[model samples]
Target: MGALTIKNVCKSYGPTDVLKGVNIDIQAGEFLILVGPSGCGKSTLLNMIAGLDGITSGEIQIDGRVVNNLPPKDRDIAMVFQSYALYPNMDIRRNISFGLEIRKVPKSEQDRIVNEVSSMLQIDQLLDRKPSQLSGGQRQRVAMGRALARKPALYLFDEPLSNLDAKLRVDMRTEIKMLHQRLKTTIVYVTHDQIEAMTLADKIAVMKGGIVQQFGSPRQLYDEPANMFVAGFMGSPSMNFIPCKVVSMGNETGVEIDGGAGTFKLPVRSNQLKSSEGQEVMLGIRPEKVTHKIESHLENSDFHLAKCRVSINEPTGPDTNIFIHMNGAKVVCRSTPDSAKDPGEEMEMMFDLSKMVFFDPKTEERLA
Candidate 1:
């Protein structure tokens, strides 16, 4: 089994702590992603797992064996680095075969493994070129090929595609996903790009300040973020936050939003409303959830329609972003390109509050 377990892991540089009590259990063949902003200790934790850094406390287990004290080579893992750390003087063939040579694999076996890995990465034609002579993407393929040739139990990737251009990054991301599916090897990938984490990982661990903020599938993180930090971090264009006071209307409780021209009450059914009356809360709604009203969506009890003046319109190919003012804050709504209105025009918009989330303004914690 290629399973991994991190128990109460901690790392420190004298008085400064980098990681604190991190715990994650990864099943065999799972694609796990470590994602967070820089200085959040993601790379530190990954280094500890790879035996490249010392652990101040706790244990790291691989396939049921504790590997905290084991050397990197003995940990039965291969790493692909962000820099595509290939030898500039050596050709791709030599670069890939060098590891097997150090391990004393027979010459014939080394040749066969090199051929297999090169073909697998579709770099067979470039095997004769040196790292300096190849494009960025080609060098990246060679880096992956070297790691694959090892056939190790765990593969660790440290921002492997960070050096590629935007288009190349997208291509490599797809390639990496395909490679993972074909090999079915356990992998631990580190990246700060939320898109990469969502697209490539079977499980994602969002970390901040040495603490794991949330851990789950991409869908869970996107739909039900644990707190404001996670909700804001995971989505593109981001979930909007509108500060408002909880108010009561007859038997229902909700918040009031003023869209420049008028005020509207959006009733919300949440247990937290029992004590949240008159308290400041942040109403969280994703851009896509707020859009041009449709007759079918208006049938839902939780759907709310309001007239708002569009302050700006940005066309993003797939959809147009309409910016409006609500509760004195700028709110973004996603509308079909043809349905979006020009700036300064009044438009009717719908809010799907069934999936809306609430958070405490002071604590930033989610409210049920």
Candidate 2:
């Protein structure tokens, strides 16, 4: 089994702590991503798992075996770094087989492993080329090939795609996903890109200020974020936050939003809203949730139409982002390109309140 468990992990340099009581567990073959902005201690935590850095406190287990004090070489793990740490002078074949050579693996076995890895990574034709002769993407594949040759219990990738261009990065992401499916090896990957985390991870741990803010399946974090920070950070356009006062309209609880054209009351039913009557709260809604009116949604009791003056319209191929002022804050609404209006034009927009989320204005925590 390739399962991994980290318990109460902490890291410190002198008096300053880098990781503070972080914990995570993953079953064999699970793809876990450590994602956050720079200096969030994701790489630091990854290093500790790989035995590259000494842990200040906590236990790391691999397949139920404690590896806290073990050295990297003894941990039965392989790492791929962002810099593509390939030997400049060594040919691809030598680079892929070097680890096996040191492990005293038989020459015949080493040759077989090299051939298999090179073929798996689709780099067999470039085996004779040196690191300098390969492109950025090619070199990355070679790096992965070297790790695959080891057949380790765990694979650690530290922002491995950060060095490649946008197109190559996307292409490589697909390749890596396919590799994980075929190998079924436990992987702990660190990346600051939220898109990568959403696309590649079976589970994601979002970190900030050396603490994990949230950890779950990507859809869980996207659909039900722990707080405003997570809701805003995980999406491309980011969820829109509008500060409004909660009020009661008939038997339904709702919030009032004042667009430039008129005031609209959107009925909402959430635990937070029940107790927050007449109190100010942040209403959270994703851009796609706020769109042009659809006939089917008109029958929903929580659906309402409002008129707003478009402040800006940005066409993004398949859809257009319409910016409008609501509750004195700029809010983005995604609409079909054909239905989008020009700037300063008054347009009718639909607000779907069924999926709206509420957060405490002071604590910034999800209230529902």
Candidate 3:
């Protein structure tokens, strides 16, 4: 059975519409992630799912039963918020077992569950210590442990790792992945971090302006983005967008790029280009897809070679980023650190057009 379903769910606060017809269907044991910039209604959708917020319209079903009117406690869901709300005076053991205690679990069973959870989270020795003594990461673990202790029908996490340091966040991310693998629990996580969304989610929902923009696996979002916003939002350094005019070159479609050496035509392999001819379009390509000319030929691929004077070069250990002018716009090319030339030097570079993406400049929609 599908674990959860949200059908045309919408939310409004008086005149402001917070969510606009959100829909999702997740299978059992799937790790679903809702990610977007702040105020995009990712949290609002999660709150509604957990019954922390009421839905304005539409139906929500948990295991085939409509749950729009169900209270949070009756929804069989547990949420871990951004803030680790650990009890200040209580020790870690008590904090983790507090929910079970309130449910009138026996003393022996509570102790057994607490010990098992602490061991799983690797906080066995710190059970006796109070929340004040634990580090940010440790405290986050305790908060997670509290939820894990219950084994609820669904786990809802709202930026649970956003409070920790960079290094610790990375560690906790891996640990959470391991935990999910072992437990096989159905989870719906919310975050604004693209890397977290990419690495942790079995499926991802990208939201913007209170609406779902795209929903798919990480590789699908990266390689075949639904629109220009998703194409620009999913990767680091972002995909480069250069404005050019679409033109016909024999049987194939091409783009005219005027990069100082004079205007040149570049072939584009898209059947959707018939209507785009003579129209302004945005050429989207990742920095890594733009590499040194030598490397392109070495890989047995023909490169669309262009010559331009380098404006800047940023060497970061493994690779060097060379910035230059292309079609009157600044473009970045990724090359080996050892092969970097100085700024102002004219160098030949290749655009791996095989991975190139085209967008309608006016609509901001992907053309191919």
Candidate 4:
């Protein structure tokens, strides 16, 4: 049996519908991520599962038992929010064991559990101090410690690292991943951060406008997106979509791209060109797939090579980000820092067409 099952769950407030027939089945010990932009209902769905908000329709089952009508306190779940939410007056030890105290757990047992959790989170020294005496990262760990103390069947995390600084956020992300590995407890995390979702989730559900856009592993979503929204949303620099036309070159059918230097035809074996020939289509390429000619590790036959002027160059430590124009659309290339030329200089580039994606211009659905 699945750990948690949400069957056709829907939520609405007054005239506004926040969730539209959302459905998901999470396996026991799976790290599930709900990721999307604001007002996309990721948090609202998490809240419904936590029983902090009511479900307008459908049922939620935990361990094969209906939990839709249960109160938050009755659910065997722990939640950690963006804000640490540690008690102001209570020391870390008290805050960590507060939930146990309310449930009438024995005093000696609570102390043992708090010590184990605090030690695991590496915050044992801070256990004697109040929240005001701890750093932001330490406090965040304490918040996690509080949740970890319960050893609950389910954990719901709502943007837990959003409040921390960038550097701290990175550190905490690793810590959370390690903690999950050690505990092997089921977790449903909500975040808009693509890196977090990609790194931590066993299964990712991308939401948009109160609907699920796609649900799959990170590689599946990147390689075969359901639509343009998902293709553009999952990557760092985002996928570049270039408008092109399918034209016939002698007896062969191919896609034409205006590379500024000249019009080049790229063969399309995956997308049947019978009906699409002489029609407009979209070409989607990721930044990493674009590269400088000299720095390209692939052989000449591996990718489609072209020459274009560098419109911009952004060096980000490990790799240089180069921008160029193709068919009136801006394209980004990830190249070695040493091989990047100055802006306005003409440079040879290779577009790795093997990994390239084709889409229907009208529907924005993948054609290849």
Candidate 5:
């Protein structure tokens, strides 16, 4: 395990700049995830860190050693690829031991390492089989086992769980988490899946358009997102954004919401909104915060009640997605299955204004 540092890293191809001033510091044994949509430079950054791609500028250090010009062999890193990348002609044992063989490790040590890794990953039974003989999940485990055998200073996972089926993905995710916990190794995992980033990483760098939008814990990026993009991209089901005009309500202020039936002001407690009075700002709230009104909601000073006609009701076992309109924009309210009503029915929803976030309409940056 090793500490990793990327300082003012920038990458470009001829005229196109790919990574712009990317900076991330991961302490030893910390799991760091680089996450974003495709073409966001996450994979490119991972490749750069692995020394597979050259650094256009800036520095990358592993264990305080600058590896800007080093080859992959000299980096002391093991990488598990998205495609499994196992040698089809070789058995699982041979595939996992290939690196050890290349490094001229003794046969006894190689066998011991392979055996230990395969056992930990529960792929001991498949060690004699070829890549084609194993299923996708098994192949992924073999790939992880191959990386584990190396015992490198850093482990790089390049969307390693993306190829598995949904159930298998979840299972493998848990397996990987357990592996990290048991080993406490320094890891840099790259995935476009926010769910993976949220569940696995000690720290996350949310990237977009060659820029690091935000770098923090999952909860920090989820609850106190730096901008609208970070707020909208980090959460599952996305945060509901309603454009509302801030207005003065006696001594305090609130944002005006048009909830189909009628317009009402949802009380907002913020000193930041004082300067934003009468201006349009995007109010962001999570679906879970807007749910079926209950007595608990009535007791909170930050909660406000409103009735809206349900446009759609989507059931997902334990919770139902109650779709409604606020300020002419489609909004989703997650409700318990027992209280979920049918479409065309009017339901009272309690808005948890305490958790509401306001963004500047023009800049798309958080205001309050």
Candidate 6:
């Protein structure tokens, strides 16, 4: 089984710390994604896990055994790199079976394994073609087939789809997910794309400045982000962070929002509302919640109506993004293309109070 554990793992090169006290655990068959912006040490962590680099302080455990001293070949793991590291001179069949040949497996067995993996990846027809002759996507499948031929306990994908085109990346993302489901294998993927991390991972570790910002199930990280960076990193169009003052008027405690036309009090559910009263805080809301007024929001007490003057509209086929200014900061609202208001027009929107998340503006930490 491919249960992996990184316990307070720290990596330093001379005086520069690349990974700082990183800790994570995942059971067999779980897909864990390391996601963040560039230079966040995500790829460095992946290399450490693969034994390609040494750990400065802490241990990495694979299947309950410490692997600090184990060589990459001795470890029961396979990796697919971003470059699709295939041999230029070798055909796809040999490229996939080369690992087995290096292990000195019988030629017949190697051929059988290569056939099985190639057929599974839908690359059977390309077996006779050299890696140089194939397209990026095809070469990627050969690389995956090469890894699948090994049947290792764990799989490491270091931005494997990063080199492909946008459409091919999406296609390969689905294929990788399907491959994982069918094999029930453990996977640790590294990527800077939040969309890939959200769609492909069961658990996500958001990294920044050589430290883990947050690590949890995708929903947990999406719904209850640990900090402002996580809130801004995980979702598309990102979460809107409105600078607002927490105010308490009578029994009502909420954040005051200036949505261009006028100011309104919207209730924000938070345990720290009392302590944060009169303090400036960041109110986080996804674009979907601040949509054009809907009938369903009428039954909810947490939903309030507010008018915002549209700055612009970005139509993305299914849903249009309505841009508007709130307290001098631009915020986006998700609405249907047909229902979206024209630019410079005023529109009524339902601001869902229940879904908003509060954060400390100074520290960027969640305020409850």
Per-residue CA lDDT of model 6 for 217-279, tens digit only, reads 999999999999999999999999899999986776888988877888887676668766888
Supply the TM-score for candidate 1: 0.97
* Per-residue alpha-carbon lDDT of candidate 5 for residues 1-368, written as tens digits (9 for 90 to 100): 23999999999999999999999998999999999999999999999999999989999999999999999999999999999899999999999999999999999999999999989999999989999999999999999999999999999999999988999999999988998999999999999999999999999999999999999999899888889999889878999999999999998888998777678888887789987789999999999889998787688788889878889999999899999888988999999988887988888888888789999978999999
TM-score for each of the candidates: 0.97, 0.97, 0.95, 0.94, 0.97, 0.97
State the lDDT at 228 in candidate 6.
98
Against the reference, the lDDT scores of all candidates come to 0.92, 0.92, 0.88, 0.88, 0.92, 0.91
C-alpha RMSD of each candidate structure in angstroms: 1.4, 1.3, 1.7, 2.0, 1.5, 1.3
Q: Give lDDT for model 1.
A: 0.92
Q: Write the residue-wise lDDT of candidate 1 on 1-368 in tens digits.
A: 33989999999999999999898998999999999999999999999989999999999998899999999999999999999899888899999999999999999999999999999899999989889989999999999999999999899999999999999999999999999998899999999999999999999999999999998999999989999999999988999999988999888888988877688888886767766789888999999999998788777887889888899999999999999989988899999998899998989999997878999888999995
What lDDT would candidate 3 get against the real structure? 0.88
User: Which run of 10 residues does model 3 get worst, by summed lDDT?
Assistant: 294-303
lDDT of 2 by residue, 191-234 (tens): 99999999999999999888999999999999999999889889
Error of 5 at 92 (Å): 1.3
Worst 10 residues of 4 by lDDT: 293-302
Give the distance in Å from residue 163's predicted Cα in candidate 1 to where it truly belongs. Answer: 0.4
